[model samples]
Target chain A: MSVKIEASEGGRPHNEILGFGLIGSLVCIYLTYLNVLTGTEIFSFFGGLGAVIALAWGSDTIKHLCSYGLGTGVPSAGMIAFGSGVIAMLFATKFGIAAPVAALVIAALLGAVIGYVSDKVVSMNIPVMVISLIELAIVGALTMMGLAAMAGGSFMFADLVAGSTTVFGIEIASYGSSVIGGSVLAVIFILGSIAVQHPFNACLGPGEQQDRTLMLAAECGFLSMIGVAVISFAFIGFGSAVVALLVSIIGWAYTYMEYIKLSRRDAYDWLDAKPIHEPKGGA
Target chain B: MENLVLGIGITALAGALATVAGAAEDTESDIGSQGDPNSQVQLAPQMGYIHRIYNKAVSGEPPAYGLWCALGAGIAWALMSIQINAVLAIVLGSAIAVFVQGVYATTAYLGRTASLAKFEQPVYIDIIKSVTTVTMAHAFVAIFTTVAMCQLMIVALGHPFPLPLLALVWGIALGAAGSATGNPFYGKERQYQEQKFGAGVPISASGNIVRYAEAGQRSSLDNGWFASKLGGPASGICFGLIVFLELWRTVLFEQIGAGWGAIIAGVVLILVFMVIDRYIETWARKTYGPYVAETEEAAS
Candidate 1:
């Protein structure tokens, strides 16, 4: 719900969107903790395209603070930056303080104390808004621990207590799939929360551009790399799930052919295919 | 405020369902044969959690009251702790709560007569008829009535609300049941819309409305202004592959005879997923053609 275009046209510069979100979250937390410490899943589809280039720099700072109007502040600050970046990246990678720290700096310091108590306690001003809610909860806890370590390869904590903890009634199966990290990690935590909040809430308006909202935020990060290559092919195989479904159908045919060349410079497609010139006294 | 933070999070979920209803019958007979009909199942995300609470309740939100009152007190403590058959979990949980409360009461009575993101284009053909009636009402319902109401309240409401109070009662009951079925299509009396596309409502000769004057901008291949129509990303990936093959046909879901080959491979995968989603929406309108094809041939 943008009002102030100010000057829009496929905009970008802001230090190339925070240098591609702090160098794409330290290169997808070093190719997802180097395939969860050398065990490997073939550079896990570039760690879900480096957490979709760190949620296209926290959805281009939610298209520059919902283009200043802030109608439903870009999905209530991306649902409180993915609910405090998936509860501080699952309690700093399952309690044991992420094996001597660095669950993306404890989900970017718990998304800078829930974006400073929602911009100083529930006001939700937004602006730099605690570093775009700690870069959309440290790229949504590094794209949910790089798509739950590329479909349960290993994000550790004994492979999330053998693929998705159960405890008392016990499940902890390890690689031999107990619904591989339980119900495909609850369907990639609800399809990575709708591929990190439907690419800037369906590319906002004045036909909000920014290279067609970072090429529809890399076509919602290649539809979360076809939902982490079809739910991490229930423990990555079939040639790394046919190379993460041919790198998400060739990254959704090169970002939908540059989003049909930026929806042909829309004024809702030239005020409905250029005709109405209603001027003199027609007002 | 958000209904006083959803009435103190549904009265601390009715005091954690009266303190986990006295440790439900030996954890419902230790996950009672993972919802019986013995083993090897595939899918049952109860029509993918009612097509993700009617596509996040008409995209904006509201509904998901403390995760459907902790999935109605975790389906009465996961059918008395998974001993299952509370009349087959209330006849598949009242047929998945009367098929997601009759697809959220027919998209809250066609969003008070056609209003998905405030109507437009042949009233966005009735807002793509509530996203093709929530992607063909989850492939004509029966996503195995949510695999024993999600393995009887997420494996017997897992010793009382783990997974961050079950992701904050499934994201505050999917935003309080999509804001009580989108509060009777709030602020009604629209009379054909497109209010300057995404509101900021300006243009006027008494603001359009000779049946909402002329219009344009529709058909989006990539989440343009909320899924640029033309089978919005092939019916949101055919309602997420009919709730990921109805919970991947209940995991270890074996079966040879009697099962008519998993009902003829789920009727040939819903007739090749409606012929590859109407051949990828007529090859994405004959290869990336419409961002408003010459404003629909200069509006007829």
Candidate 2:
């Protein structure tokens, strides 16, 4: 039997990373609104970057929560975060320009309540459960909003739910269905869930390190950005979508290489495997 | 003023349905032996204690229910768009989702059991043929009730979210409630019955579950019957309260002070629960005390 030993006073505190992540991502995502308010899509990619930053923080929160021996709760926690985030986001976006701050506050309250229930009613008995869940809920909401902003060029409810499209040379009012009515929100939900959950699930073990896991988290975020960028063709112009796609690819490549380097540094040894041997005759 | 009364009515009806859905969801999972306890069940045969427990953990509770509820609600939404009767649409959609869940249950059980062939654990066709129907029945109740609740939110309460999205959100919440609140009762009290009550699972006893029944070998069917009594109800209350309180706060306080009232109510509710939780933890600790080593107890 192997015993899991957690450090009590080592590495960066989750709160510190959370502060940087929260402030940095909020600034980036809110700045992207300049494009929407100006009726331009130039700064849409900043929303994608904001999503990556928030997801990095979300990955750390997942790691901290699962470290408490949640058993099968790893996936549940991820789903719960997104589930609550979506509702809070839907509500917050109705406030027009205040969507970002509104989503942050709404998700925190929702997360706090859920965390309290998990600990008190369900008796999870973890000390940091409430705070960790609050961070996750907030991150989940922001990541979704960022991705939505990336895809639709705005986070406002009116823009997402009723934005028109230009077909051929004519501008089609409502375009039969808007970005959200066309089921882009569903796609965002699944993509955000996978991006937030896959990092720690892939890297967790006795040998797991925070930096490598966080790098992988960034890589996953960029990968999700690529998907969101591809889907943006349904909403934004081709030139803007292509720009987001290019930025996502560059970010993904950089982080992926950094993650690999960290993995090799922390690994005991690396071996290159040879091709499979053939048995002289083909089957 | 009329809207407030109508909202309260909708909230009450939705809360009741949520309770039923939550209970059925937990019971279905327990019957199938899904989630974390499933790891222990899988390890049983490898540890030289072969038994006939149904093992069908294809995924965790949240994602599974999310998929099921989303499909159900999506199909129903499509049918409703075509001017179909809402009740009939929900029933037909729920039926289709149950069929999908049945397929998953069968395949997961067969694949998991087949992999344990090296351990000499025989595949129980009888279980596959019988338990599949049982789980599907429970899943239908859960799916139908959840879909109905989403409909109520949309038609009665004027929730802005579309039907399928609402279903997805509540479905995930329901699965979380079941996984967190009800799973422990089935996993600890039923599977590891040999361990003393109120004492947590010891490290050494991992994967070593009680393999025998009172008269014959234990099976997941029996486990389900046991869990339905206590675990199912506990999960119901958990999810019910979550839905009730959330909707209740929004209905009463959302119009007050630019929605800060609802937010404040939520935070206040959380603080209250935190205090209650602190008391529960202390009481449980005082009652159970620390775990004593088995060897030391025997020696004494």
**Candidate number of the best DockQ:** 2
| Top model number, lDDT | 2
lDDT digits (tens) for residues A1-283 of candidate 2: 1223461225688888899889988988898888957878978888899999999999889888887776456666777889888888889999888899999999999999998998788987788889888888998899999988998889898888875544565766662346578556775676677668756655544455677777877887887787677657656777888899899989988987786566555543332322111122211
Query: Which 10 successive residues of model 1 chain A have the least lDDT summed?
Result: A267-276
Off by over 4 Å in 2: A1-179, A182-283, B294-300
* Every model's DockQ: 0.03, 0.03
lDDT of 1 by residue, A1-283 (tens): 1245432554668568877676765566456566656866766676677667767776776666556666445555666666666665566655442521366688778878877887778875655667766767776776666666655455555656553323477755444233233334444444455445555555453334566666766666665565456545545556776787688778867875665455444322112223223233322
lDDT of 1 at B115: 17
Candidate 2 chain A minimal-lDDT segment of 10 residues:
A274-283
Please write out the lDDT profile of model 2 over residues B100-171, one tens digit for every residue. Answer: 577557545644454455455555666767788999999999999999998999888888887778888888
Residue lDDT tens for model 1, B1-300: 563444334334433332222111111111110111001100111111000111222123321222222223233222332345454653433343333323332322222111111111111223334333343232122122222233334443222333223433443433333223222121111211434332322323122321212353221111122221222233223323333453333221324455556566677777987898899999988896645444666998
lDDT accuracy of residue A48 in candidate 1: 70
At residue B293, candidate 2 shows an lDDT of 75
Give the runs in model 1 whose Cα sits over 4 Å from its true position.
A1-15, A18-24, A27-53, A56-58, A61-142, A146-180, A184-186, A189-199, A207-283, B1-260, B265-300
